[model samples]
Target: MENITFNHIYTLGNIVFENEIYKHYHYPEMLVRYDSNFLAFKKMPSIDEFKAAFTYLRNYHMKHGQSHVKFTFPENQKPPEGFLEYLNDNDFLYGYNELYEIQPDQFPRLKDNPDININPVTAENLDAFLTLQYTFDEEYGEEFAKQKVALHNRNFKDEQIMQVLAYYRGLPAGSVDIIISEDTAEIDQLSVLDTMQRKGIGGRLQKFVMDHFPQKTIILVADGNDTPREMYQKQNYQYVGFKYECIKVFE
Candidate 1:
């Protein structure tokens, strides 16, 4: 992947995540919630700035009864010297995530499921979109599901975003969010119901997004340790690079 293009995708994703959190929480500034309550920064601080940043976040969360601290860096970037060791010394658990990308032209031909129809979400179908998302995410527990649905609802108000829902024989079966930038189209929070897996609903939705923004580059991130990255590779997405993530949970 082109390095500039890759960075653009990463920056766009950070903006998308931060915006979603702000809208969901009704906060004025860019902030994110992880593990239910702790707030996180959109961009990683440099090594020299890490301590002050960490202290502030820690104090705010601890004061608010939040018990976790998390930090994520963009691909090919490293945290400040001893950042991981500091977290380790402080009992912070850490991990990493894989970032993936695909050109619309490179996406494989999806098996057209005649029964499935993917459409942009509008006010008329907003409820269906939220319900489908809640169903797919409910396993994460009620609070997470509720927040996710709320995030999507808030994202709908953003002109740069296009929320999609796939219907199988008149029932919502899958959903995804597309964040459109001038040069790229970033796909986020793609989900299909458990019962609808392996039925081509996801691929159909993917194709729908490509068709919707035929000229822009498409990008997404997947868990490095999970099966989804492999699946994305099979669908013609490339494993461009990955970022390291570290988190600490307070006792």
Candidate 2:
């Protein structure tokens, strides 16, 4: 497999600015989605450069009534000297994301459960899908949930995007959005209801992807600090690379 970089990851946001140092992505419709709006640095910068970039993103987000500033550093690159300490001192939350990919043959075959039925989101099941998404998004807040539903509504019309809901015994219990390209199927927003976890619903969802797109490479980004990455590894997904990111949220 070729080396994977952050540039290979799929994103729905539009790039608003790009230069030698960094690129800015913005999706005004989904202000609360950190992945949709962020500054991605191409290289580690001096403290002064970091501050300038932070100020620019902070002011840009504030102008749009957004309360967060996010920055993604170059993939597989260590931060500049004192950068982590600087972020900690300034109350910035920092983490990294591990990118993983798996071929169809590498993915394990999951046992099919009669109780679990996965379906593509369409007119007939859109409400159930939205309900499941809203239930998850509501953790952030009602307003954020509403906005996310609207964004999903827009995404539903896109030909490259496919949202699926996993029903456990006739109830929507898990959901994921797949962004398809010619050679890849990127899985995003995969979640299972807390009440229905540990029942193999998550693996079933991945099996759905494998069954549907057997020829394309399946990829996803996982929080480097989270347990889900461990699950991915156990499921035979290859860890490709990681990118560091930090964010500050205003009250």
Choose the strongest candidate by lDDT. 2
Off by over 4 Å in 2: none
Candidate 2, residue 48: Cα displacement in angstroms equals 1.0
- lDDT of model 1, residue 16: 18
Residue 220 alpha-carbon offset, candidate 2, angstroms: 0.5
TM per candidate:
0.78, 0.97
Q: What TM-score does candidate 2 get on C-alpha atoms?
A: 0.97
**lDDT tens per residue, model 1, 67-99:** 556665555666665776776787776766777
Clashing pairs in 1: none
**Candidate 2: which pairs clash?**
none
Clashing residue pair totals per candidate (backbone < 3 A): 0, 0
The segments of candidate 1 whose C-alpha lies over 4 angstroms from its true place after superposition are: 1-32, 35-53, 77-90
Best by TM-score: 2
